[model samples]
Target: MKQKSIYLIRHGETDYNRQGIVQGSGVDSDLNAMGQAQAQAFYQAYQHIPFAKVYTSKLRRTMQSVQFFIDAGIAHESYEGLNEISWGVREGKMPNSFDNEYYRTLIENWAAGHTDYPTDQGESPEQVANRQKPVIDLILSRPDENPILVCMHGRAIRILLSWLMNEKLATMDLYEHSNLCLYKLIYSYETKEFTIEVSNDSTHLLALVMHQ
Candidate 1:
C-alpha cells in the first residue's frame, strides 16, 4: 500500500507564549526571538529534505516559522482550517488572575475531559476538530505533497492529530506538543487510513538554545 506523508511543526514561540498571553487564531502575532532561533534550528536540521509543499494556517506565526522555506523557493499555501482555536475575548490577555480567568478555565476544562466546551466567544475542541477535517482531506487528496511541510499552532494541531489517530477528542492532548516540535502522519491510499509516523519530536533543536 502506498502511503502519503506529511512533516508537521508547531510554530515557534511568540512573545505571548513567553509572557503567558493568549495568542490563538484571533491573535496574529509573529515569532519572538526565541521563536526565530527555533525556526532557524529546524531549517538547518532538515534543510536536506525537499519538501513537496509547505502549508500553514492564515496566521503570521505559522507563516513566519516557515519563511526560510519560502525564501528557499519552496512552494507554499495557506488554509484557515489550520489556524489555532480562537481564544475569544482572551485573545490578547494574559492567562493570569490579573488579566483573565476565562483562559485558565478553558485550559483546565479541556484537560479535564471537557473537550467540547467552547470559549465564551471562541471555539471548542469539537469545533476545532470539525474545521481541521478539510485540511486533512486536502492533504490526503494531494499525494504529490508527500513530505508536505505543515506549520501550525499548538492546541489546534493536537485536535488535528487526534482526528488522524481516531482517538477521542477528550484525549487529544494526550499527544505531547512543544514549540518547533515536529510530528509526522502518513495516510495509506490503498486502505484509506492514517498513521502517525512521529509525534512531539524536538531533538533536532536540543541544546541549540534555552527558552522559557
Candidate 2:
C-alpha cells in the first residue's frame, strides 16, 4: 500500500497576533518581521525535501509564509477554501477587555464543540470545516508520490485537522501551535485514513525566536 504524505502549516504571525487581536477571514494582514523570519527558517529547514505541490490560503499572511518556497523555485497554488473562518462583525475590533464576557463566551463555546453557533456574524466551526474538507479531499486524491505543503490559518487548520482525524473540533484546544508551526500527516489511500507523523514542529524557528 502506497502512502501519501501532507505537511500542514499554520501561517506566520501577523501584526494582529502581536496585538492580541482575533482576526478571521475578513482580515488580510501580512506577516510581521518575526513572522517573515520564521517563514524563512521553515523554508531553510525543508529545502532538502522535494515537495510535489504547495497550497496556500488567499490571505496575505498565509501567502507570505509560503513565499519563501516560491523564492526558492517551488511551484505552488492558492485556494480560497484555505482561508480562515470569516469573523464577520468582529473582523477588525479588539475585544473591550481580555475578559470581555461576550467574547469569552463565544471562544469558550467554540472550544467546547458548539459548531453551529456563530459569534458576531462569524462562520461557525462547522462552516469552516465545510470549506476546508473539500480542499483536503482534493489533496488526498492526488496521485503524486512526493509530499504536499498546505499553508493556511490557525482556525482553519484546526478545523481541517479535526475533520481529518474524525475528532471533535474542541480537541483543537489540546494542540498549541505557534507561528509557522509544521505538522506532518500520512494518508493511506487504501483506507482513506490519515496518521499524524508530527505536530507543531519549529526546530527551524528556535534560533530565530532566540535572536528576538
Candidate 3:
C-alpha cells in the first residue's frame, strides 16, 4: 500500500525560552538568535525534499522557523490549530521561586500520567487534543501524493503524535524534543495506520553546532 508522509518540525527556541518565561498562547513571540540559526540549519538540511505543502502554527516562532522554507520556494500554509496550548493566567510570568513551585507541580502531574489535570488557568491534554484532532484529520484526508511539512509548537506536536499513535497522553513526557527537531511520519493508505519513521532527528543541527 502506498503511504502518505508528513514531516513534523518543532519551532526553534524563542525569547521566552531563553528567558525562562511562560509564553503559552497569550503572546506571539519571535525566535531568538539561536532559533534563527537553527531554522537556517533545518532549511539547508531538508532543501532536497520536494514537499507538496508546508503548514505552520500562527505563532511568530513557528512562522519564523518555516519562513526559510517558503523563501526557498516551497508551497506553504499557516494554521491556528497548530498553535501551542494556552497557559492562561500564567502566560507572562517569569520562572521565579513563587512560580517555580506551581510550575513544578504542574509539570510533575502532567508527567505522572495526569492528562486531565491542568494548571489553574491552563489547558488540559485532553482539551488540546480535542482542538488539534480536527485539523490533523483534515490534513490526513488530503491526497496521498501530497507530502506535508508541519511546523508547530512542542506541546501541540506531542499531543497530536500521541493521538495518532493511540498512546496515552502521559507518554509524551518521556520524549525529549529539541528546538527545530524534525520527525518523519508515514501513514498507510490502505489500513489507515500511521507510523513514525523518525522522532526528534536533529543531526542537521548537531552538525551545524559542531561546525560552529
Candidate 4:
C-alpha cells in the first residue's frame, strides 16, 4: 500500500480572531503580527520536511501562514473549498448576547445530528463537506505530491478531519484547534484509510506559548 503524509494546519490569528469577531470565508483578512511570528515558528520547526507541495484555502490568511514555504519555491495551490464556513450575517460581527445564544443553539443542533442546519443564510457543515470532496479527491489522486502541507481555517479543518476519519459531522467539535496548530495524518492507498499521527499538536509553538 502506498502511503502519504499530510501535514494539515490552520491559519494563524487575524485581528478578527483577536477581537473575537467572526471572520468567515467571505472576510478575506491577513495575519496579524503575532500570527506572523507563529507562522515563522512553525516554518522553522518543520523546514526540514521537504514538502512536495503547499495547499491553502483561497483566503489570504491561509496563504500568508504558509508564505515562507511558498516563497521557497515549493509548488502551491489554492482552493475555495478549503475556505472557512460562512457564518452569513454573523460574519465580521462581534458576538453579542443574542449572537452567543444563537451560536450555542447552532452548535447544539449540529451536535444533535442536525448537520444540515446552517446559520442565518450561511453554509451548513454538510454543504462544506460536499464542496471539499472534489478537492480531497484531487489531492489523493496526485501520486507526485506524496507529502503535502495544507493550511486552512479552523472550522474547515474540523470538518475535513471528521470527513477524512468517517466520523459523524456532529462530532466535528471534538477536533480542537488553535492558530497554526498541526495535524499530521497518513493515508494508505490500499486500505483507503487515514491514520492520524498527531492531532492538534502545538509543540512547535513552545516559544510563543510563553508570550501568548
Candidate 5:
C-alpha cells in the first residue's frame, strides 16, 4: 500500500454557469471565454507539479478545464462516475421563482437527512456516491499513479469528498466549491483514510481576481 496525493478541482465556468442556468449531467457544454482564461490560470499555477495522471468526467467541459495538462502529454482518462449529477427537469433551465423555491425545499430536505431524495427524475446523493465507488476504488488501487489530478463538477465533488471523509451526505454542503477551486487531499493506504490538506482553495485565482 502506498500513499497518494489527489488534486481535485471543479471544472471552470461555462455559459450555463455565467448565465445562472442549471447544467447537470444531461447538458454537455463547452467552457466559455472566462472558463478558458480560468483554465490557463490553473495551468500556469500547477504546471510544475509533475502530475502522474489526469482524470475528468466524460463531459467535455471537465476535459477542457484541464486541457493544458493533457496537451502537455500527461496520461488522461475520463469516467462517467465523475460526471455531474443529472438535474432532470431543471437541466439547462434558467432559474425562475418556482425553480428557486423548489431548490430551497430540496436542500432543506437534504439537510433534514433525506439525502436519498432525488430531484424530479434526477439523481440522489446516494446514487451519485454509489457510481463513484468504483472510480475511487480504482484510484486507490493504482498506487503508481500518485499525485493525480481530477477535474469534476460541483455537486459531484461535494458528494465524493463526503464519502472519502466518512461524512454523511447531508453534511456535504460544508464542502463548498467554486469553478476551478482546488481541494488537495492525501490518502494514507496504511490507515485507509483521507486527509484534506486543502479545502476549497482558490488562491491561484487571485491574479485573475485582481485583473477583474
Candidate 6:
C-alpha cells in the first residue's frame, strides 16, 4: 500500500460565521479579517509540506481560506463535492430563529444518531457522505507519494473525516471544529486504509489558541 498524507482544513470565518448565521453550501462568503490572518498563519506553519495538489469546495470561503497557496502557484482545483451540507431554506438565515427550528432540530437529531432527518428541502447527512466519499476514494486510488490539501467547510469536513476514517457517519460532528482548524489523515496503501493522524488541530495559530 502506498503511504500518503491528506490535510483537511475548514474555511476561514466569514461575516455570517461571526454573526452566528447559517452558511450552508448555498451561501458563499469570503473570509473576514481574522479569517485572513488565520489563513496566513496556517500557511506559514505548514507551507513546507510540499503538497501535490490542493482541492477546495466551490464556495468562496474555502478558496479564500487557502488563498495563499493559490497565490504561490500551487496546483489547485475546485469541486462542488466539497461544499457544506445544504441547510435548505436556512442557508443564509440565523441559527436559532423560528424558521430554522426544524433545521436546529435536524442537526440535533443528527448528533443524536438520526442521520436521516432533515428539514424542508435540506440534505440528509447521508447525502453529504455520498457526495464527499467519491472524491476521497479517487484521491486515495492514486499511486503517488505526494500529499494533498483539501479546504472545505465545517460540517462537510466532519462528514469527510468520518468517511475517511471509516467511522460511523452519524457522529461526524462529535469532534470540535474551529474555523480554519486542520485535520490530517494518513493512508496506507498496503492495507488500503486511512488513519487519523490529527483532528481539529489549531496549534499553528499559536497566540490564537483561544480562537474559535
Q: Candidate 2: list runs displaced more than 4 Å.
A: none
The clash number for model 2 is: 0
* lDDT of candidate 2 over 121-179, digit per residue (tens): 77888888888878777777676746878898887887788878888887766666878
Clashing pairs for predicted structure model 3, backbone only: none
- Candidate 3 — which residues are off by over 4 angstroms? none
TM-scores for every candidate against the unseen true structure: 0.92, 0.94, 0.92, 0.98, 0.98, 0.92
Model 6: what TM-score? 0.92
Per-candidate clashes come to: 0, 0, 0, 0, 0, 3
Q: How accurate is candidate 2 locally (lDDT)?
A: 0.83
Instruction: Using lDDT as the measure, name the better of candidate 5 and candidate 6.
Output: 5
State the lDDT of candidate 3 residue by residue for 1-107, as single tens digits. Answer: 67789999999988888787878777799898889999998989888888888888778898899897888788777877778888878887776797888878877
Residue range with the least summed lDDT across 10 consecutive positions in model 4: 203-212
Q: How many collisions between residues are there in candidate 3?
A: 0
Report the lDDT tens digits of candidate 4 across residue range 1-212: 69989999999989999999999998999999989998999999999999999999999999999999998899999999999999999998889999989999999999999999987989999999999999999999996797999999999998999989999999999999999999999999989999999999999999997986
Report lDDT (Cα) of residue 139, candidate 3. 86
| Alpha-carbon lDDT of model 5 | 0.95
lDDT of 6 by residue, 1-212 (tens): 45988898988878998998888988888899989999999999999988888989899999888889988888888988889999888788766667666656777888888777765687888888888877777777765737989898888877777766677877786767999899887888888788888989988887665765
Q: Cα RMSD (Å) per model?
A: 2.1, 1.6, 1.7, 0.8, 0.9, 2.1
Model 6 lowest lDDT segment of ten: 95-104
Clashing pairs in 2: none
Model 5 lDDT tens row, 44-104: 9999999999999999999999999999999999999999988899999999999999999
Clashing pairs in 6: 1-189, 1-190, 2-189
Query: In what order do the candidates fall by lDDT, top score first?
Result: 5, 4, 1, 3, 6, 2
Residue 146, candidate 1: alpha-carbon lDDT: 69
lDDT, model 1, position 147: 79
